[model samples]
Target: MAEATEKKAKTKKKSANQTLVIVESPAKAKTIEKYLGPGYTVKASMGHLIDLPKSRIAINVEDNFQPEYITVRGKAKLLKELQKDAKKSDTVLLASDNDREGEAIAWHLKNAIQDKTEAKIGRIVFNEITPVAIKEAVKNPGEIIEAKVNAQKARRVLDRLVGYNLSPLLWSKVKNGLSAGRVQSVALRLICEREEEVENFLPEEYWTLDADFVKGKSSFTAQLVTYKGEKPVLKSESDVNNIIEEIKNAECKVVGIKHTDKVVRPKAPFTTSKLQQSAANKLGFTSRKTMQIAQQLYEGVNIGTSRVGLITYMRTDSVRISQTALDEVRDWISKNHPEDLPAEQIQYAVGKGAQDAHEGIRPTYVTYTPDSVKEYLTRDQLRLYTIIWERFVSSQMNNAKTRTTSAEIQAGDAVFRVSASKIVDKGFYRVIHLLSSKEDSTGSLPALKEGEALSATKFYPEQHFTQGPARFTDASIVKTLEEKGIGRPSTYAPIISVLLDRYYVTRVNKQLVPTQLGRMICKILVESFPDVINETFTAEVENDLDSVEQDKLVWNNMIGDFYTPFKNRVDEVMEKQESVKGFLDETTDKICEKCGKPMVKKLGRFGFFLACSGFPECHNTRSIPLAKCPMPECNGEIVARKTKGRGKEFYGCTNYPTCNFISHFKPVDQYCPKCGWFMVEKYDKKNGSYKSCINPDCDYLHSVTEAVEEAQKEALAKENQALKLAEEASKENQD
Candidate 1:
């Protein structure tokens, strides 16, 4: 009997030693399992196995605004698998990302599985997925932080309150399918206001004069800066012409020469916002694309025989780097190029309101260079990893040095100045120069004395129009949002994406352009809910969320303060606001085919469409015609159509059954100059709008405005030359 009891105890002990690990993604699980070998079973939750229902507002307003949690739809099978694994294991470790969302995910998984198993549960976090880091995290695990979970919950509830309560009001007042968000509405307002400014802007004419001078064999050009000991303001072409006449025969002499040494320090490593901005400007990537690639690098990639995370946490705002990482990078710099190493290790300052929970984005291992692991990563993954490696490596290097020379030349009453810079030392720039968009070299300048004489070779005057405020691009918008504290690192990409998905903004020439529907929705929201969409108010709410994360403020109280007044305002707007259908719709001349009633142009979620005036009696709708059909031997007109699933716009013949002609480009009335084929307006993010011939055989394309302006200029020049010749002939006759 004693021997039987000993055998049973031994079996129980062997079963109790097995452990199960859960993470947010399969890739992350795979990499972590590689570090922690056998006796551990790893599984992925695939992000948020539970959340609030979408059918209704799940918050109990009377009960401290407690959210009603439920197993998320379509996650029952995944939960069953996790529960089965948890029941058999003695311990469970929740290894999610180190952020508010990740914290909430870990908390949810714990609540779901703890009831079914006697396993001890804990949370483990690591900034990077290196083998050493993973093992260290597993050895020292901590419980889930309630403060971080509460912060994430508070944000989700606030957004749900605004979106659920206000979206219905919009549907009744404006149109159906139009939704509003706390942060996206503010972004939409910005785009609409910028569009208004662009429309109302009036260009003013301006001019500048430049002179070319030669001291010996070298030639240099300088702009006119001062005239008659005062700064000249060339407001018109006449002013430029007068300056040109004065400098045409005047002798040029170098009056002032100055030299200065400038140091260009290396920028800090990649914070989430800075990384998105740099990727947008340098790689022409949208914020969404940048974040997507960054996630893949952070999760893990298969490099050779081992799986490894290429970068640290990418969703961080802090510029802090670990001391060990700094030491390792410094040693690398000293070994590879001793001249580029700084005297001491450099430390970067953390920005205002930073959470500082994780290190800045950097390569997990300095030894795994981008080139060494290029074969394992995709093109985008490799490009992003290269930038992360270069940025972090360069951040610890020495500053670059440059020598700048400014030469001021006097030509009669006008003063022309020119400045040039040459690189003296390529320290950090040696790595950054490969990723920079613009060239840094200014070329070498010839030596000149202050009193040296120079002969004026030619004078040129150019006319220019003053430009208005530039439209916001993806990079500029992210920068603006960061500066204003409107959103955090995780929210930037989603905010911009929501605007685009809802048709509130369109990318044209890499600039955000508000559509007509976007303008209408923004006007309605701005006028009715001024406090909700105000930038200052929104930023304060973001701060409140941060306070919740820091345990300074209770999540329920903050939501109450915002919801009480916000709900009242929403009620007032719903009662007082008038329907915009009457103002937005216009009567059309075409009659409906169903009931022979005149059609009216009405705005829908997609765009403008023609609907019957007698809607109840004759329910008919059709797409509005954009232009005449470009196809030969077809009398049908071209109407706007959308792709089946993606809803992308295209133009097609109205008589599609008989004459099947379609064009992705928007059709215009004008014909092409080269082939006499109908022209279409094609748009791209790089180029705003251009006209192209419909005939693919003819390669004719030009900008819409540039072609017209060139023709006008040529006609005006001919008229001016004819008048000059007539005056010369008359002078000859008189002589």
Candidate 2:
């Protein structure tokens, strides 16, 4: 007991003169503590101890738009503990992230605990969490930038004003619980408009003619590009037939050949937008998931003897790299891949409106390659880290070299062309090739002079339809948002998340499609608040926010300029806009079991369902049936349902507590020819809509077009028979 008490006293004495470093996350705190070693005590703030409460707007619109911030609920006790630590330490250093949000956090921390301590309070920041970086930051602490804090405050106050005012109008005019956001509404509009384009698209037919030619031992296919010195525009089967008949037996000869060398440069390192886009495209990760995983990597990961951050700050828009990082990466390449190293350092051009806050996302230390740290990381962590490392190293490497050969063949008046490319040098690709496809496009052909004779083995004409603009996937949407400057680095994932959480958009095979409710809400917001909820105005607002960060504009003045006009628009729309509450409901033939009143299909938080028309008097609701159950003698119907937690859509039997038939895919009213089991509708961007068997052992599949036609005919026949039965039943009731 004496020894234990003495040891505790010694520990207290040891920390009595220590400097305290506060960070946003526990993982980051742990990593920094290891680097700071003995004279410092580290603690995690857990991100934003104080912020505007969620229950109210918390903005004093009348008093120069002052924000009313309170200690975040459930964090009061944590704040008290931090204050106690601050009072004990000799100095407090706020070490959060390296962005506007982080600057706000550091400023908030100084205010929250300054009264409790006589210690010097200052801010310290680094792009990556390493021993050298952390120690160097502690050696030179500076005051928080007031400009960054004001910029964050400006964004917060503006969003609250928009959401708090516009949401009420949405609730009254559209439906209760409906909400609007300054940025998310714009994203919803983009998706809804794209859906409209798709629905209105009319595909037109086109044809391409190709010939398989044999040159000695080499065989290659070439597409006909021109006919009689004009571009071929084959619109129908007759046009293709006419062209084929005119050139079927003409002697084919090579008329011209050209060769050229091409140089392909490496892409810049990952910015927040580029990381999200690349992860979505190559790794099939959503923007939210990509950011989540990236956060984990940036905070820290456990290695052999300590915790270290694997990547630089993840929420940056800059492609800038520090000289230290550049030197280390260049040295690594010189030792490992000497041939790929460039003579001079490479620098990427920053985009027109990038924040340029921190270095682009990259590995903190080049020595910790992906393969070396594979055992310490999760599968996803490794995957994300690998891409970051590759992109950074490749950005500074030499350009790739390739050679291409183009050959033209003439058959009567028709001219066919083919091109082949071969990689002569793999420079940056030495690292980035893992993420890229490795297929060689070169088809070996015999070297021949101009006017050489070639024999045609077969001629084929293929029919195709011009496809409409594709709907936005996670990757494409992020790219579009970045290009249009709709939101900043921190808001991209949250924008998608907010829309999805509110059910404004749903992922249909990884493609974002607005729901009926989503489309209606978008229409209401756009038609009512065009000036505010538009892409151009929103982008301009973003630029103004950036100006505030640069200390060129006052945050309060920016808010003042936007609020009065926006508030007036909201008031105008509320008083004038018509209610669309029951506008989307469809009256159905289903009669409520509780009351004799007919049932109507209404959209809800989950999805569509049948509700009693006599609502307030007799309240009842049931799922709408999509197809009859395929089980023998089951006599049940399949209906759409959502999983409880995730809200993922699935189909199951309406007789759920009784007959348990469920499928992840929606069941169509068609059965497989090979196996007598029912087929379900499935969709993907590559294949469009198709049908697949639900049975695990069966492999039955077919296109949805023919299946839908047959199902519709069957449905019409069933409707007629049901009508005849209903007439007889009515006559009997009258009797």
lDDT per residue for candidate 2 within 56-170, as digits (tens), equals 9989988999999999999999999999999888999999887888898888889999999988898999988888888899999998999999999999999999999988998
Off by over 4 Å in 2: 1-16, 435-437, 440-442, 585-587, 592-598, 612-620, 630-634, 642-648, 656-663, 667-681, 684-686, 690-735
Residue ranges of candidate 1 with Cα displaced over 4 Å: 1-13, 433-438, 591-599, 611-622, 629-735
Question: lDDT tens digits, residues 385-412, model 1?
Answer: 8888999999999999988899999988
Q: Global lDDT of each model?
A: 0.87, 0.88
Q: Report RMSD for candidate 2.
A: 6.8
TM-score of model 2 (CA atoms) = 0.90
- Candidate 2 at 387: error in angstroms? 1.1
In angstroms, give how far residue 608 of model 1 lies from its true place.
Answer: 1.7
**Alpha-carbon TM-score of each model against the true structure:** 0.88, 0.90
What value does the lDDT take at residue 608 in candidate 1?
A: 85
Task: Return the clash pairs for model 1, or none.
Answer: none
**All predictions: root-mean-square deviation over Cα?**
8.5, 6.8
